[model samples]
Target chain A: MSMIGDIARLPAGVPETAARPQVSVATAEDYVALLKPRVMSLVVFTALVGLMAAPGPIHPVLAFTALLCIAVGAGASGALNMWYDADIDALMTRTAGRPIPRRRIAPGEALGFGITLAGFAVVVLGLLVSWLAAALLAFTILFYVVVYTMWLKRSTPQNIVIGGAAGALPPVIGWAAVTGSITLEPLLLFLIIFVWTPPHFWALALIRTEDYARAGVPMLPVVAGAAATRRQIMIYSLLLIPVGASPWLFGYAGLVYGLTALVAGALMLAFAWRVWTRTEGKAATTAARQMFIYSILYLFGLFAVLLVESIAGRVVG
Target chain B: MDNKPDPTELTEEQKRSRRSRSIAIAMVLGVLVVLFYFVTLVKGPAVLNRPL
Candidate 1:
């Protein structure tokens, strides 16, 4: 059925604006923006590490397909998140310029787009790769959209803490794609990302407390205040040090990864310490922002080290 | 004479966006087809024998 025809058939008592066909001026780029490409890139990178690190070899085509499916799945969840959060998104300065908040895409259109891509990604993964991986991808999308976005985000300060699991699942899903099974190593990767999330996000939340407050989001800094959030960041950063080093300790990775994790993790703890100490004025915000930036580099560094070591081990052996 | 814009008529920007979205969909479909073809080539006749 034509969109115009559907609009024309609107029942009586419907608003006149609802009856009029709203022509979207959204371009392909707007749709891509809905995917949250930066987030997808991180998901792709982590999943790639998991895929390459798995025991045995995966065909190049299948490996590419697995990563593609995982990326699309992550993007789909992001689109749905934007669709649901359009109201709060408009309120926050940080998210105010997003496609939906800016009115470049309609909420319903984003919903449909997200659902379509999600189904496509899951089915493709299941068909071309392993069903276990497909199931994990489906669960990740559902967990992010339903459990995190719809349920927890507005309700609690620990939302990101629990929601981090969804983000952390990609590497596990990647491993399942390669081995068709779960193991300790992938779970270790999951643990690293899971623990890494709260401190990383809480740092941003510290700087953007006003934004979260304005949007009524219960971010840790907004709800518990910066001091408490800083303490939590310290705790998580301390925990992440041990979790990040597990792959090497467990003997899956070599000395290089072990050394990299220890040094990088200590640096992360130092940044978190700075965030913990500087709790007032411009110095505080600066500290939080620096930690936030370093958190990204710390994760990328650890995962990049793992990827390099995995590849090197494969080549040398 | 009424100066109101027609609800049925799309503005130039809307037309361009619609065209862009259409092309993106076409490209995605094309990629899916090629992907399936490659998977078939990799799996050979066993492509049909999918295990749960």
Candidate 2:
């Protein structure tokens, strides 16, 4: 609160009315935007798959509690990200309309909202699930906001590579929330997302090259050029194929999931190949966009297959 | 500051909007509190067994 009060005194349109700044009433939709609901949905789904796939079954309420905690924690990270990136967010055409950049929510309000949600989620998870899960959730939020967004994003082109760990932690947290410990199974899931992040993100970064460059964010495409980025995307895609298949190879999943992984992996590689092979303007951008869109489906399909297989296994046996 | 509107001088419309926003935020907070109670109930052992 004091920090927000201090920000109010600055000339950054903090509203000179020190007693009560005239802020527009933020709508429910604005709050939802702050939560980055799209990203939160993915987090919830992946975490749910993790929870369901774990060895033991949990009470329904506790399971829902854990999922809710992870969702809130992910949202908190998004809010903090918006808070810090408000400056650059205003610069980039892609992000110029985000809540903070558009002045729909004040930076201080965002920070407070993020911190409060994060604290509440962590505490509730610890009390309801296990301290270990809560700790991982807390670390995920901190790493995403402080380490990735604040430090590496602006400093290094390898930002997503290192920062991908935060995104990868959800399943592990979910696994821990259920089992109260980490295991090889959840670690394999973690590796899949970890290896998948670069190609998935770089494909989009390829098209948003100008936006990143204008924002002064050192995305791989902006820093290393389009050709190099394309090559790296292919490399990561190749690596992803095997890792994506690991859950199947390890016997953790059945025929349905195995086939899904194989097909998804092939399509991912083929698209990345297209991205690499195409050298022209619109064609190359189109390829990258195709890869980007397919990458989302690939991940979702892979996880969906896993969830379905797990449910079938539970019912059959 | 001149930019700060006095709460007492607020028009009826402004006051109504403020009241609605306040209620919405309060409702969200209340729901969260209810959720906490449910969590505590579900994991009573964990919540109760933790050493203060």
Candidate 3:
């Protein structure tokens, strides 16, 4: 018999045949996708701002190393997150195309990859930069992977609220990389991102309520309904204005940063107000989407202003 | 006698992917070496004086 005919005639449900080992076809790009490059970029940018805002001077080489370690640490957390949440990711429309969900990379492979990178990033940062910074980076990874991803994410509607701590730590880590100590300035930066995360993420959750519901993840919109989520978004947005502007109030930032914060923050409030009032049909969804998009811009604008002012001060002095 | 292909053998696509992953790992290793070298240069003799 021909090979094709023999295979076709073989027992359809044979356990032995089904147990055949398959070689991995996962490429480098699939591995990179596991790292969640978009999230890493935001981490790198925020860490850079923190490093630049620090009081002391850092060698350019050391600064680069610090940023690199923070970026890798963030990526490692993202990979581990994908590994653990692969089941939920496969169910959600937004994440269904991820490497693990698509079966391009095995969950075990992602776990190993995340662990290796996490160790390498932490060890290198400790050896090359301040161990304080390294410690913070290590804590950030643990919080994101263990505390947030494993504990908070599946359990409560306030998952991202408390989990934002991990995301807010990069700037603090960056500051520690420079000074080997934490201060009010980096804490203020932490405060801004922490407050920003809820309104930002809830806007996305508002649009993907069904996705979260299907995945059995208790996102705010899934647990509290759209009306409550919008109200919460408005509340957080209101809270963010004062928190976002506090750096200038404390005299850590210059006039440019203060003005930018007030105007941009007002716009953020306006967007949240729209999300609050337009609570029906396509208008509500559009308002949420617009707020989501603007939130990214609002954060980038605030940080870019601070970074530029810091650079300008350095040059002038 | 059956002339069936070996299930253990990699397909062409799998071979390509494996090669790409190997190259990427090699490049990362190379970059780490250069990074450590520069770090040492920047720190001078103070590199060994790591504080807890």
Model 2: CA > 4 A from native: A1-21, B1-20, B44-46
| Every prediction: chain A TM-score | 0.95, 0.93, 0.94
lDDT of 1 at A40: 100
- Candidate 2 local Cα displacement, residue A176, angstroms: 0.6
lDDT of each: 0.94, 0.88, 0.93
The digit string of per-residue lDDT tens for model 1 on A196-269 reads 99999999999889999999999998888888898999999999998999999999888999999999999999
Q: Tens digit of lDDT per residue, candidate 3, span A53-157?
A: 999899999999999999999999999999999999999999999999998999999999999999999999999999999999999999999999999999999
Residue pairs with backbone overlap in model 1: none
lDDT of 1 at A234: 93
Better of 1 and 2 by DockQ: 1
Off by over 4 Å in 3: A1-21, B1-7
Compute each candidate's TM-score over C-alphas: 0.94, 0.89, 0.94
True contacts preserved, each candidate?
0.68, 0.20, 0.70
List model 2 lDDT by residue over A152-211, tens digit each: 999999999999999998989988988888989999999999999999999999999999
